[model samples]
Target chain A: MAAVGTPLNRTLVRVRKPFSEDRTTAVVATTLSVLALTYPLIDRALNLGALDDLFPIVVYILLALGLNIVVGFAGLLDLGYAAFFAIGAYTVAILTSPSSPVASWLPFELNFWAALILAFFTAAIFGVILGAPTLRLRGDYLAIVTLGFGEIVPIVFRNAVGLTKGDQGLNAIAQPNIFGYELNSSTLWGWWYLLMLVGLLIIFMARRLRDSRLGRAWMAMREDEIAAASMGIDLVKTKLFAFALGASFSGLAGVLFASRYSFANPSQFEFSTSVLLLSMVILGGLGNIWGVIVGGLLLGVFDRILSARATGWIQGLGDATGIELLEKVNLRDSRVGFFGLTLVLMMLLRPEGLLPNAQRKRELEAQATPEGEVRVDETLYDKRGEPL
Target chain B: MQDLIQALLTGLALGSVFALIALGYTLVYGIIELINFAHGDLFMLTSFAALTVLEAFAIGRGSPLGTKVGALFLALLVAMLFGAVVNVLIERLAYRRLRNAPRLTPLISAIGMSFILIQIGQYWKGSRPLDVPRVINRLDLLGPLDIGVRFFLRDLILILVTIPILLGLLYVVNRTRIGKAMRATAQDRDASALMGIDINRTIAFAFLLGGALAGAAGVMYGQYTLTTDYQRGFETGLKAFTAAVLGGIGNLNGAVLGGLLIGIIQAMSERFLQNGSAWANAVIFAILITILVFRPSGLLGEQTPDKA
Candidate 1:
């Protein structure tokens, strides 16, 4: 087993704190720069009532960040992230809604901030619960098991009518309120955007964690668990922390999602959402924060733009072709086709991802091995693709 | 007593189907250590293919024996061909390219292929569940003990037919030249290649055999359930995969035993456990987790040098 800072230590480490003098200045400058650059588009979109278009992007960005911790930094494939999102949303729903038991327990009604805290903890506890027992399994087995958990959670939420209202979903979930002021109606977007800003702050904190000793431990475990353990990295605790923290963000995202939508439903948290989140991590380049943000925004906006315009595009093509069957093409269904195609193309063209971490990029580049040349050793190309 | 007997019978029948599907998962995982996420979708496609072939036979309106026999043979052939072609294409297009990539890369590709297959199926058959025409006769015999023991003769015959055939497959896998080559390839791909075995051909053969079994399972499942849905394979696939893992993923006989155990467990849980139907999935996962924790190599799994 290699020591933490040995020759094989290829883990990328950002030494500066995420919100340190340099990073803060960079963030502020970038924000100002971006705002200045997109001023015209922002103005036009806002003028046209397209501000809501940014909401899903914000939500997805947060989801992507949360998932990156588990799947990217920690190298744990989680297919049930939406379950945590569902949990957070349902937590908020159960606490703030007029129908909730939480309202009855309090002297006065608890607001969204309080509910948000509760939701985060509720989802986090569930995350820990789920992660505790299953974190010991091997990687692919972990993925399948998590996939099962993802499938099972929603079904439970949907069928447990006494608690979750089943498929009917919890409606009339209250929006967030800060002290005397209430964020309601169209104004709700302001609060949601603020919440997303806070989520970005959390992402910054997560970025810090990614560079910490804990982060190094996670990377080690991901590279080789046995080796990591041999080097005295506490496997159990480190894995639990990854699970817990990854799930905490998912829970937080759920709170924002619930409050933004003002509804909590099981249908919203499906297996496909998990796939989308995973794709975001992959597309953005795992272990790269900025890449994940870009990936999330691209996929989120792509989904919205494509779904809205796909029918029109299909209709135009159908008209040109004089084919009635083509006219019936539903862009909504075709979105999945687009996602599939994108993944395939991405794998073929840039397997390392759009903004891959330096180390991951190098690893992928190393595997290409100049196309036609065959490595002589038969054991060299095992499942891990490493020479034995 | 009657309920117990009925449950056992149903469990065995369902277990047979699970075992068949699981064989596909185990075989592929055995050979290449790939999970073949698209496998369930393959199973679903094969079911539709069976339906298409059976429909062409006009078996729904014919004599039971002739229709059953004809539909059985035609459906199996068509389904097997579909499975083989699809599996081969999947290997070539999605998996083969990722041979040198990380484990996660191929898994993601499998997922992408799954979506593609499902979309294609939806486009062809529409998203709605299609009813498979019943062409087999059901036989119910009164027990000598006067305890009612109702049985579907088709299920009994299906199991009786499938078990022997599956056992024959086991024999071939353990004894035949191709089978030995497959084992060698699975144990060490590069070594087998160096020894003049075509690694790609061995993988294709594995996929071919796995696909054929999935096709057979689809035929049996269609006959038993009388309906096939695009999404039907998802849950069944997960369960069968669980069985494969439970019995030791790359071990052939282990998959068979695991499938039967899972099938019986599922049936028993649904019949006896509280809120059984609702919790059945969770129970299966709980069992999987337990197995993983206690015996990661699975019941009959041997430790391979290459780690996935």
Candidate 2:
């Protein structure tokens, strides 16, 4: 949205060249979109049963992409990103679910689509409310504050039995309707097509934003706050916008998650889920949209399918070999451990992530002088926290 | 008045445990300025180790007092050593290399380390809460003195064990060469390195002491509460972290004071407020958020400019 030659737009032309000039990237993106659109139908025709987990994984990717806006793009480490996810789902459930206690007080059950829109705004508002105060603090303190908020949200939801029905949770939520047909978890094909379109649109929007003036501001702030401020970037506004935007994306995913499952529960928004999403983002590559998607898909498939199958195979082998220790082995119990290992190993060996952003990869790999000073290449970038 | 006094006393005993754990957090945070997220889980592992040791000795309610004491001492030693060793290992394996990297790198790694420790605890002890055998008799110690209040022997034991350790820690930090090195490192790592102080060893020593404190807290908590679980680490770790922050993170006396205050608040709420037990965590988290926002330096911390 920035006009040409404004302070933030100096490097826009330079940054847009590489991606736009690459024909292969465009072709690969198009191919992936087409495949994503058709996968559900193919799975159904073959009775592959991949649809069951694929839908949730899509939602997860959507979430990771949203998180990328904050942790990756904006450079804010949010340990409680799931709190926004919870808020989004709970908002929709409380509004549209017949089982929700709010039904007694409210005159009508809101339409699913209307509730979804409301949930997005609700999550965004909450994001600002949380970010406004905490973002003023330093990075790590903001992390702990967000973590505190994340831990508190579920507790409040769980304890507020009158509204959320306590541990039993809100079920039988209204499903999104297309014409006369209602879409639920069983209508996997419909949900898949809808989510695929949403995901694609979001991916497109994310790309556009990445090239926009605001995105540059976020990157500027993330790289160096004081310098970004000196360059006339509003640090508070940029950080808050990123935080709110990231939250809204998670909210969108939450609405889809609740609508598909037809249930909303506190347990679904645990700290573990947040960490799992973080792992996906890190494993795929931070700050890269496609990388996040790949990371999300890889880990999601592993968690939902491969891990279980591998465990069963191991157990079967143990039975055949009569090895008692192998028979007792349970991979599910070690799932979190695996994620933890991914995080530690990734940070240690490849902090730039698997599919690092071009700029990020360069920054991480930038050569250091013998005196231990990083020599920033002035040809590619300036000290204003911009690419060029 | 009677209930209030009882709550206060119980809170003091509970606070002592939190203080121990909180020391570990404050110590590590003080030296490295990195939140050792795995410290709480380290405490949990130590508790499990202690449990296993006690189980091996078959020390239970039926055991003789002298034998029980001896077994308890052995369990304590094992737990401390286990905690210290494991903590040092985590620092070496996960955190050591990332010392010069960005702040978030080691933090994320610490979180991973925490999850791994939780997994280990789960595999060792199963997921459910295990009932810890009550080795000390629950005899009322305050009744003999006609104090018109009930203070159990367990409470006395908790205080007796914790206070001395706290004093010993204070003495070491104030009087020992290594402790001075830790303070020097905390003040400025690069400068300390330039001065020829072994930064790695000082950092490792901080972890060792912190881990020992966590180990001591774990055994005391498991024994006092009569239960231990894998998930206990996250909850207790958060509370202890809160204590550390409340008392001015990186401040020893601050952590102890914060711990006792939090314990008292929890006890008062759980006893006085309706459904307070369920809401206690929420209250603590609220306090953490509020304090960090309003007084980021904490009650006892110096007002360092926000390190952007």
Candidate 3:
């Protein structure tokens, strides 16, 4: 009874390194957490009216982290990631919104906290349903299927007027409450702190997953699918887990988004949203958690703050110079163009991204020269992961 | 039955235009495995070019038949040239360097290019839809023949333009030396390079050919729909890409067949299904997912050896 075989031992493996082991990661994480915690105070002191506008962007960063798992870790290209976001938002909207069809059909409205939990599972189920059939296909084909699914989901939401309210969408979703205080749009500090916590939690979880056994399997599969499978990895299971897990994160984001906005609309989730999230992931550096956070923040600031300000500056120049052409110029609606340019230029000039993952940077640099030549010696070593 | 036949005729006309665009996708994909996401936006830009030409000539419905015909022909050639030049430039500047990069690299670049082109389109035409003056006669060709179903002159024109382009494309790919080089390069880029084929030139030729087709399709689409908008590219491109995928992505004949089938389905759905206009796109997307999952090879596509 005291020692049956091997005395009951709880500790099997050490998952995390001591803080001193990785000074850079530790310092960066601490600095970011401190800054995030103080951001509302900073915004208030500076009189920057950006606090409200910047709220949803935290959710976007969460989304990019989720996408990183599938695209970066598993090496699956998902062009329809926004569909999962939409599904999650709709789940929360339907369960908690007073105007939802559920209000008429069911006797009780689900609690916001409970609905948030439900949204994650609902979106994950949808992810499994979509991923099961297409996971076995080639990478590009999987992209097309996901793109189709993205297009179809919004259409379903728009057409099912009874369930989704068609184009009008669901309104008056319940906001999160604790004790005597409620978290809504007006409580900017409340939401700012809440989202910051959620973001930190997700980052912690994503990092842990990245360093776990499954993470290694994902990297192996990404490098060589056949070799990974031959090494006894279950390809479909590994892929499906990444897909569903990624989807659940988006679902969580969707709930936060709907609750904060107090509404869910079909127009909010579109192909452009998917592309925007992708650019953030790529811009930050795929597969790197910190890189994605920085990338998402830069883009969010640019999208929410700088883009509009740039238009104003352009008009101001035009007014100062009395130049009609300059006056008429507007970059306010040119977000798509800017994102597009970012994608192309980044791919062409710095495909490894702004904060390149060490291994990916090595793989990319080793693959090509300025003249697009595959140096014979480099190719041999890069392919089989050998240092000659 | 009459409605069905009429729908079929309209579908065929629409299908012909889709086929032209799908051919461009198929040809480019056949040679280079990129999806050319900007191809649809290029089509949009070409239609704007055609509109500029028509407006420059001041050609309208009231113009004499001879003037109308001359202006349209000029527009077609100009649009084709414009499309070909831009497409080649895109290949040289945006895509060539990424040829040997990861497969996703080029695809993402193409998506970026699509967005850029779309922005250009918005700047050129503004956000509102523009009306294309009816330069062709609206008389029904099948009326005098008493076929019991109406077939408009526009439908005839689409068919007439399409058949020649299809045949000419077939001849070029099957019989021409440049075509031979294209096929060779597609089979093996390094092997073709060893054989002294100028790989870049051959690829440029494919883009030129594809762009020309897109230009022609643009002109026909403008006249058929009588309206063009910057956003038209996204919708039309999605449908044409679906057609390309449905037919077996790299096969020329398969693209045409797929285009026609998609057109028929769209038209029939619009005519028969409740709220069909709104639901039509959803149906196509559903079909696309189903096909990719169940049969990635498509109707006529051979099992691509690259899947492994």
Best by DockQ: 2
lDDT of 1 by residue, B5-64 (tens): 777887788888989999999999888888998898889989999999888877765456
DockQ of the candidate models in sequence: 0.43, 0.68, 0.67
TM-score preference between candidates 2 and 3, better one:
2
Badly placed stretches (over 4 Å) of model 2 are A1-31, A366-372, A376-388, B144-149
- lDDT values for all models: 0.78, 0.87, 0.86
Model 1 steric clash pairs: A378-B190
Model 1: residues with Cα > 4 Å off, grouped in runs: A1-48, A101-108, A320-325, A367-388, B61-64, B141-146, B303-308
Fnat, model 2, is 0.75
**In candidate 3, how many Å is residue B269 off?**
1.4
Where is model 3 more than 4 Å wrong at Cα?
A1-28, A366-388, B144-148
Q: Chain A only: give the TM-score of model 3.
A: 0.88
Ranking by TM-score: 2, 3, 1
TM-score for candidate 1, please give it: 0.89
The per-candidate count of clashes, in order, stands at 1, 0, 0
**What's model 3's lDDT at B129?**
93
Summarize candidate 2's per-residue lDDT along A235-321 as a digit string, tens digits. Answer: 888989998999999999999999889999999998988999999999988888887888898888888878888899999999999
